[model samples]
Target: MEGTKPKAGCPRAAGRVGESGMEGALVWLIYQRAPGVGRRRMAQLMRTYPDPEVAWRLGKAELAAVRGFRPDIVEALLAVRKSAEARRDAERELERARRAGLRVLCYGTRGYPERLAEIPVPPPVLYQYGPWEPDGRPVVAIVGTRRPTAYGLAVAEQLGRELAQLGAVVVSGMARGIDTEAHRGALEAGGTSVAVLGGGADVCYPQESAALYRQMRETGAILSEQPPGTAPRPENFPERNRIITGLSHGVILVEAGERSGTLITAAHAIEQDRDLFVVPGPVTSPLSRGLYKYVRDGAGLAVSAAQVLEDLGFLPSAEGPLHFTPRGLTELEQRVLGWMGSAPWWPGDLAESSGLPLPEVQACLTMLEIRSAVRRLPDGQYIRIG
Candidate 1:
């Protein structure tokens, strides 16, 4: 036995196959394949098992002892083990990433983002390439509609440029419209900007953003949680949007409609307890409606980069344009606030423009009204009080 090669059935033979880091990747592969197993559940399981190879050694009953493990999950786990195709597929992806100059950061790696680790359920394994230093400075996420109006584009560009000029890293999804404008504005200003991709970091989504993506890779960085070579799927975008928010100190909603996916990103920001800012948009435009609702609901109104910088404590209280005491409300608060340069809006029109249900729209409006921040018009509309 001492001179003989170990049998294939031996535990040591299995151990000889994959080493520690590679084993972790394989665990992630199996975890990814397990139906209904998401990042959070995988995290929970990993916390308990800590060793992927060991976890794989467990029988159905043993695995069932883990929380969140169900019969279907057990079956999925077993299936993943038996699926030679999954192993081959993962190996191919791994090799592809190696050839493409991409690196992966599985959850328990040295290169993982520290801020992301603080979240309740961080991604199990994050795929990324290019520069990823936090640089010990606050990050701000600027996002908006994929199809922004000219006004929206202008605000995104101006804000991004100014924010970068001031030393804050501008972050966005690199989608078209506002996101693209934000990244471009920052880069044009010679500032660092990060593009969080919905697909693999190596795979550019909007196709038109290829140039911008290249610029970011050169000047800043493009990051994603998906594996390298993974194509953009409809579901992956929203999930990646969460990471975009998670990595930021605050999120600026530029020109989102009520149902815009950008709002979902904003929701993730709120969930992360990050500061929320919204640019005022014309009530006449559906694009600005979501922004109006946010402004009414006590989100910081970003009229200028100075205001945002001041609110985030990035600047001394004394550094911005003179802070004026807000004037009390009156009947014409509607007409005047309504006409205030197409930046802000009233609630009724915001709802109509944003296409959000009346209840959600009213909820935002009511909150704004109670704060004396917005006045209700006699016409049953709401406008910013200040």
Candidate 2:
């Protein structure tokens, strides 16, 4: 069994594999389609058995011995396993997924996301479609109202663009307003982004985001816990929210009114111990109600993109390169940098040559110095060091 490769259509095991090794993925597939079985229930079973294959081997009487599995859940589990129809359906679904070229990852698959596994009751099976790989870049989730005001849209797009430009992965639900603009910003910046869907991985829910969905699948990923062909039901959004936050180190709330679904994501972030930051918007706007309240209750305020990075411990409070991106430099800083060469140029000369004010030039020089792109000479001259 040492070099045994999982043959095509052979369901790879998550934890300990039984004789077949296909039990884990197949059982998970069955449960995904089975009624009365869900994430929490699956989690409970995993707690006791450690592997779906092990759980699958348990008879009805033995399964009843597992604590915390309610009678109904136990009954459903037994029923699903015994029903031949259920197994055929799960196999058919998995086969469809395979034919579609989608990646159906069990929890312990080689390519499964680590951050997602850290959450409480993480999805047993994650359906992914796109090029997704682990990278050193940090990930941040941005959530907001579906019906965002002009201001909210601007802020969401700005956050997405800035975060992506800094080489951070932007995560968001592919909903309307804020989510749409956020993903668009990431794409515009040529950055990686992940969209967690409330519906099936292949179904573009809003119908309008179809093009964006395809674009994401091309460059990034569009994934969901829901099985393929599953409709976007009202109850599925909250379930989708947990995954959005779980995959990121931090969550940015751009705009959310009271009772907004965005709040559900925020709650998940808190439960997962992910950093929470809220963008402060105009108090007059109803969209800001939930976000402003979070700030009031002690969430980090997103005054700028730098603040979020700094809070994540990616930035130096005093001075340093701070993972500076060329695109992130201020306009004046870019202008000042353009004027520099191997030779040192004092701020006075730079301002005069670039047609910028001396004070602005000096400010840019200081910023550049802090960024470690320039070194300050004894005579107050600046030279590009990096």
Q: On a 0 to 100 scale, what is the lDDT of residue 30 in model 1?
A: 59
lDDT (0-100) at residue 61 of candidate 1?
88
TM-score of each: 0.70, 0.74
* Tens-digit per-residue lDDT, 1-386, candidate 2: 21456544434433233322234567676655556776776766656675555566677777778766677877787677667787787776666566566677666445567778778878877778889665435688889998898988998889899988877788999899999999989989998889999888978878998888988899999988877878899999998999999988789998888989999999999899888999887888888876776777778988777679768655321222333223377766765665664468878887888899988888888888888667898887887642
State candidate 2's TM-score. 0.74
Q: Candidate 2: misplaced stretches above 4 Å?
A: 1-23, 32-36, 59-65, 315-386
**What C-alpha lDDT do the candidate models reach, one value each?**
0.70, 0.76
lDDT of 1: 0.70
Best model per lDDT: 2
- In candidate 1, residue 110 scores what lDDT? 50
**Per-residue lDDT over 108-140 for candidate 1, one digit per residue giving the tens place of the 0 to 100 score:** 545556667656566766655557566445578
